[model samples]
Target: MKLKFFGAAREVGRSCILVEGKSTRILLDAGVKVGEEEAEVPTIPNSMLQSIDAVIITHAHLDHCGYLPHLYSNGFNGPVYALKPTLEIANVMVNDYLKLSNPRDVNKDWQKKMQRKEKTVEYHQEFRVKDLALKLVPAGHILGSSMVEVRLGNERILYTGDINLKTTRLLEPAYTEYLKADTLITESTYGGDKDTWPPEKDVLSGLMKSIKTTLDNEGKVIVPSFAVGRAQEVLFILDDYMRSGTIPKVPIFVDGMIGKVNRIYRHNVIFCKDELQKRILMSEDDPFKSSNFVMIEGKADRSKVLKHQGAAIIVTTSGMLKGGPVIKYLERMGSDSLNKLLLVGYQAVGTPGRELQDGAKEITLDGKKIKMGIKVETFHLSAHADRPQLLRLAGRIQGLKNIFIVHGEERKMMELAAALGKHYKVTVPVLDAEYTT
Candidate 1:
C-alpha cells in the first residue's frame, strides 16, 4: 500500500489523503482550504483523477468534504462513502458551497448529480470494494464524524480524521478500542506543547464571566461560531447554564446557517452521546429549543437585532469572522466598549478572528475598517485534542509500524512527531510526499 499527502501536510486546512492498494485507489478526503476569499482544494494529478475509485468522507466539515462536488465537476463520478448523518450534513454544506462559489451550477441538475453519488455507511460496519475493506468508527470530533479504517490483504491502516478523545457536551469521546494498525495516519491540529487547554469548567466560567460583564453593562454579546459543531456547543452550554441558574438568561439569537445545521443535529440524535440521546428521548426535554433561543431568519429580523439596544447574545456563523451574518452583527456591535466577542474555536492565521485575537485595534469588515472597542475574550472550546490527548490516543493503537502526522502547521506537526516518535517510528510528511508500507 502507498499513501500520499496532498494537502494539510504542514497546514491546518484542505485536509486530504490518498491511499492506493493493488486493486483500489481511494481518496480519504478531498476538502477545501477555507478562511480565505478563494479556498484551496487538494492537488490531485489529472492522470490520477479518473483512476481514483472512491472518496471516503470522515465528517461534514468544509475542510474535509467541501471539495467532493468539485470532484464531480472534474468527471470523477465514483460513489462517495460516509456516515448517514455526514451524508445529510454534507448535502447542506456542499450545496451551500456550490451556491456561493459556482452559482451557475446551483440548479436541479447539479443537485441530482450530488444525490446519485452518495453511499451511506453505518458505523463500525465493514464494507468492501474490490480488494479493499473499509470501516468507519466513531470519531468524537462532531456528529457523524469517524475514523476510517482500511484493510487490504495482510496490511491494516487507520486514519484518525479530526478526532477528539475527550467528551464534550455534544458528543461522546472518540472510540479507542481497536488497538492494532500497520500504518497510522493522524491529524496534529493541536499537537504543539503550547496548545494545552484548561479544565472545561474553568473555560466555561471565564466565558460566562465575560458574557455577564457585557450584559451587566447593558451591552450585547456577539459570538462568531462555526455553523456546525461550535455553534451547537455554544448554544448547549449557554442553555444549560441558564437553566441551572449559573448565568442570566438572555435572548440568544441563532442566525446564519446554524439553525439549519442544528436541525440536522436534531435529525441525527443517534450519533450524539448516550446522555444527549436519552434527553432527546425524554418528554419535554429538547435541549436545542430553549425559550431564550430565538431563531433569527430573514433580513428584517437581523436588522432588528442590529438595532436593538437591550442586552442579548447573538450566535452566528463564519467562526473566524471571515464572512456570514457575524459580519453584520460585528458591524453593529464592534465599536461598543461594553459589548463582548467571545471566540470559541481555532482561528486561522490570516482570518479576521486571528487578527482580533492577536489584539488588533481595528479590523476590516466588508471593505471598511471598524474600530474594535468591544471586549474580546478567548475560551479554549476546540473540538480537536491537545498535545497530551493526542499522545494518549496514539498510545492506544498497538503495533504501529509508521505514524504519519498531517493536518497541522509545520511546527505543530514536528512537535507531535517528536513526541510520538519516542515510542513509535513517526514521519511528519511534507505536502505531496508519498510513503509505502
Candidate 2:
C-alpha cells in the first residue's frame, strides 16, 4: 500500500490524499485552500487525473471538497462518493466558491456534470472501489462530515477528515467504537500545546456576556460566520440562550447563503444529535423556525436590516471577513464601540478577522482603510478537536501503529507529531511527499 500527500501536507487547506492499493487508486478530498490572495488547489498533475479510480469527499467545507468542479473540468471522470447531505451541502458551497472566485476555466457544464456524478452512501456501509473497500463514520465536525476508513488486502487505514471529538449544540461526538486500523491519517488543525479550549460552559458564558453587553447598550452585534456549520451552530446557541432567558431576545438577521444552508441542515436533521432531531420532530420547539431568527431576502432586506431601530444580532457569512454581507455590516457598524463583532471560529492568517483579533485599529477593505471601533471578541467554538482531544482520539483506536499528521501549520503538526511519537511511529509529511507500508 502507498499514500501520497498532494495537498494539506503540513498546511491547513487543500486536503488531497491518494491511496493506492495494488492496482486500485483512490483520491481522498480534492479541496482548495482559501483565505489567500489566490485559492490553491492540489498539486496533482492533469495527466495523472484520469488514472485515479474514485474520489471520496469527507464533507462539504470548501477546504475539503471545493475542487471537485475543477477536477471535473480538467479530465477526471470517475464517480464522486459522499454522504447524501455532504453532496447537498457541497453543491451550495462549491457553487458559492465558483461565483466568488470566478475561475474562468470551470464552466457551468462541468459543474452540472460533476453534480450528476455524485454517489451518496450511508454511514458504515461497506463499499468497494475495485480492489479496495471503504466506509465512512461520523466526524462530528458538521452535519455530514465523516472519517474515511479504507481496507486494502490485510491493511486498514483511517483518515480523520477534520474531526471533532466533543459534541456541540447541533451534533454528537465522533464515532470511536471498536475501530481498528494499522495506519492513521489525522488532521492537526489544533494540535499544539496552547490549543486547549475552555470548558463548554465557560466558552458559552463568555460569548453570551459579549452579546449581552452589546445588546444592553442598544447596539447591534455582527457575527461573521461560515454559512455551512458555524452559522448554524451560532444560531442554535443564540436560540437556546434566549429561550432560557440567559440573553435578551433580539432579531437575528440571517444574511448571505446561511439561510439556504440552514434549510439543508434542517432537511438533514437525521444526521444531527438525537436531542436536536427530537426537538425538530416531536415538539413545537423547532430551532430552525425560531421566531428570533429572520432571513434576509436580498440587498433591500440587508439595507433595511441595517436600519433596524433597537438591539439585534446580525449573523452573516464569509466567516473570515474575506467577502460577503458581513463586510457591508462592518463598514456601517464597525466604527461604533457599542456594537460588537463576535468571531466564533478560527481566523486564518492574512484575513480581516485575524487582523481584528490581533487588535488592528484600521484595516484596508476594498482599497480603503476603515477604522474599526466595534468591540471584537473570539470564542473558541472551533469544529476541530484540540490537542488533548486529538491525543485521546488517537489513543482510542485499536491496532494503530503508524500515525501521519496533516492539515495543520508546521509548528502545530510538529508538536502533535512529537507527542504521538512516544507511543507510535509518527510522520509529518510535507507537500508532495509519499509513504509506503
User: What do the candidate models score in CA lDDT, each in turn?
Assistant: 0.87, 0.91
Question: Which 10 residues in a row give candidate 2 its minimum summed lDDT?
Answer: 33-42
RMSD (CA, angstroms), candidate 2: 1.0
What digit string (tens of lDDT, one per residue) describes model 2 on residues 91-132? 999988988887867977888999999999999999999999
Residue ranges of candidate 1 with Cα displaced over 4 Å? 103-111
lDDT of 2: 0.91
Error of 2 at 307 (Å): 1.7
Best by TM-score: 2
Q: Which number leads on lDDT?
A: 2
Tens digit per residue, CA lDDT, model 1, 242-346? 888777777889999999999999988889998988888977899987787999988999998888878999999889998889998888889888889999998
Q: Per-candidate TM vs. native? A: 0.97, 0.98
